[model samples]
Target: MTSIDPQAKFRTGAVDMTHGGGGRAMAVLIEDLFHRHLKNTILDQGHDAAVLEMPPGRLVMSTDAHVISPLFFPGGDIGSLSVHGTLNDLAMAGARPVSLTASFILEEGFPLADLERIVISMARAAREAGVPVVSGDTKVVEKGKGDGVFITTTGVGVLPEGVSISPAAAKPGQAVLLSGTIGDHGVAILSKRENLTFETEIQSDSAALHGLVGSMVDAVPGISVLRDPTRGGLATALNEIAHASKVGVMLDEGEIPVRPDVEGVCELLGLDPLYVANEGKLICICEASDADRLLEIMKAHPLGQNAAKIGEIVEDTDCMVVMKTGFGGSRVVDWLSGEQLPRIC
Candidate 1:
């Protein structure tokens, strides 16, 4: 790779086929934009792959792809969303994330300014999460063949000894907890796509949750299961845990917090808050004895201030998730039948 002029016309230029042809243009893009923002010791090594030193513990890895439409939203863009999404997956497994690798598929004719913005956002998110992007690859597709850009991020983490969390770990007499309010991210994306406005702006809750997870693990290492309800939201997540553990879940609708504005938007759109996506919230299942402590730990964290003990696990061969409606009726919260909001983190 060769250095390019500092004033490389990014402000008004667009990506073209030459940028991915493995030549001068490609080198300039890598050196001037990607490397400039995402530089770190390991990444600056300029190797084909990252040489990583693993911590003395179980290895955990997770990968996520971001193809969110509109690319940017009120609270987050595809860049930070990719980082948070992958790191959150590792956190769910009780792992401390070490590093991340990001790959971008850029559409021909995409604006360089926007691409630069995305890279900068990704770098900031990774730095704030105490993780570095150590390796990456980029390619350009034909203009008519792709969206503006798609980001795929993979994260690696280490799980400490005596910590084991899995979907199948939930058992009877366990408590189910939520990290915070739901439907924020999904509604934010929908509002942006549809050009809808509300009295108060709704922002996506796109944040990395590993710090919160670390505190929880330090306090309660015996946590049974942890899951981030992303695409299918809380209802689908609970259904998955129920089937995996062969247990039943009973939830209090009032206990699950949803923002008033989000609820109003859902009602107006004829959508269920339970089926909407969330980027920052998580579902925690643990022994009833540890519930209070876990909730305390979660609530103290910045990301989980709205944490709530929503439900409990029960012995049931059928593996169902039932919720006690605030209206004094109970209903089964089944898996989401279809995509509530597509390309939503």
Candidate 2:
């Protein structure tokens, strides 16, 4: 019979090669740790694959990797982030995420307890999003060959007909809307890093935006483009769309949403809030006529309560994002150079 405490040794020590050597150690760990938190019929099938009953619609897929330093941070961790990040990507395309696949690369000496904690968090996040991790793979590298752990997640979702949105579809006279405040994710990550001078705590707005996207898509099927501002922030995201769609934008900086604390932090750090990353926000470009209806839908949702109409597309030098300053000046919002926040998911 298997011992009651299969991870007894692993609990008190670091991972060893033998634990993944296709032996008793490996069996015990899988059955004891993974099976405990992720008990489901599909996983129990366990024949090198997860059997799935997928729904009908146009299939949409997205993949993302989570490697942010300080895996555990305010509002989220690498585990929850892995789930939300990929889910949001699919949602941006108006897809309903159904299943996910997770792959883990672990350092040889990482703690088994921490690994278990991450897996539990991943399961919880999937449940909250109404998605499931149908399958996964794990590999171990030499202690120094990898970080504590890095996760790559792939998600498959379904998009309803008549709901097509793309960056190339952005057009002139379209109104631009931002879901909520900006720069929360960037400041949150910076605050947690050492040698950075900051007193107040700032939590990362890392969340899955699928629910909000669904509401918007249902309310307005004619939306032009939907992009989640992630590593490069909102400025770069809009620029990409401008070049792809051959459109120009005139943005009002005062209309863009930014928390007072976030604004203060950016000023203190000499960082432009427009260049800051946001994981929980999105940029939606739609026709001028549809803006009012869409704004109503957005304001009703919790995630988009602070939503605002920030700009409008126009015919000008294509591929240019022009921002009208609050002080009556015009400036171009360009892509960020080099890495402002490295390892930011």
Candidate 3:
């Protein structure tokens, strides 16, 4: 039997079914590509599983799969989105992410160069967030059976004592806060979609929010709800929280932040910015008394510089999300009926 070359250059090479055969090809791909970029002490152990000491606190775990179209976008790609999305899930639960595990499904004939670029980007994002990818698996599919690549990431974190945050904790009379502008991510992906062009490039707001979430938890331990509006955007996320807490949301349209460019793009495409997705923004539901303080804390963080108090929880049997229009009319902000932008992480 011939052994795969560990030192073989992959610049012009493409993934093949043998890479996922759990043989020499698979070993070389894991050790040379995945390990070469994401290697850590635990991962270096090369065991089938990673073992670690658990911190003295409650644990939080979240997983996400990334299948965004146009692997590369203005400010991010599926790679970074996979890391940020998973970490943000843990952050929303008031957890300090400790580690991540990634899984990749690569299509045969997919360019090795592109795969390496995505891996490098994922590694960079994890490093910037102070979380390491401790374990991962790779598989190759038939040439036409899979998209270029799909990444699945699972993240784990520890929650501090006395910090309890959940959608069910929301109560009437609580204030709602937004970490930053909306629609940036959705529009960014739309702009970069094949044959879709806009006057200016709109970058995805994809980022790891655990740092900002940590600061908020420190400043206001009693925060009721912390949610990042991702796929369904602000409207759908708010609706979910409302239903969970059996409350209503009253939003001031004028207070919600939307970039002028993003607004224009939404209007041009006949899309509602409220329904558009955002990768880096969060929705905070807290006691009305702490709203001002939480807003201040959020604004101080780089990721929360555009933080604004956009709404408040209210009593409503219907558990609806209502937005006061700029023109003095009120409208219901309903759950997104269908995918506004498919394949958006």
Top of the candidates by TM-score: 1
- Residue-level error in angstroms, candidate 2, position 205: 0.8
RMSD of 2: 1.8
TM-score of 2: 0.95
Q: Between prediction 2 and prediction 3, which has the larger TM-score?
A: 3
Cα shift from native, residue 253, model 1 (Å): 0.5
lDDT agreement of model 3 with the native: 0.91
lDDT of 2 at 111: 91
lDDT of 3 by residue, 91-147 (tens): 999999999999999999998878888989998999999899998988889988999
Query: How high a TM-score does candidate 1 get?
Result: 0.98
Candidate 2 or 1, higher TM-score: 1
Candidate 2 ranges with C-alpha deviation above 4 Å: 1-4, 7-10, 195-200
Instruction: Tell me the whole-model lDDT of each prediction, alpha carbons only.
Output: 0.94, 0.86, 0.91
Q: Tens digits of per-residue lDDT for model 2 on 285-344?
A: 999999988888889988899999999999876589999998999998888888777888
Model 1: how large is the Cα RMSD against the reference? Answer: 1.3
lDDT of 1 by residue, 1-345 (tens): 345454467888899998889898887889889999999999999897999898899999999989999799999999999999999999999999999999999999999999999999999999999999999999999989999999999999999999999999999999999999999999999999999998889999999999999999999999999999999899999999999999999999999999999999999899999999999999999999999999999999999999999999999899999999989999999999966888887
Query: lDDT order of candidates, best first?
Result: 1, 3, 2
Error of 3 at 149 (Å): 0.7
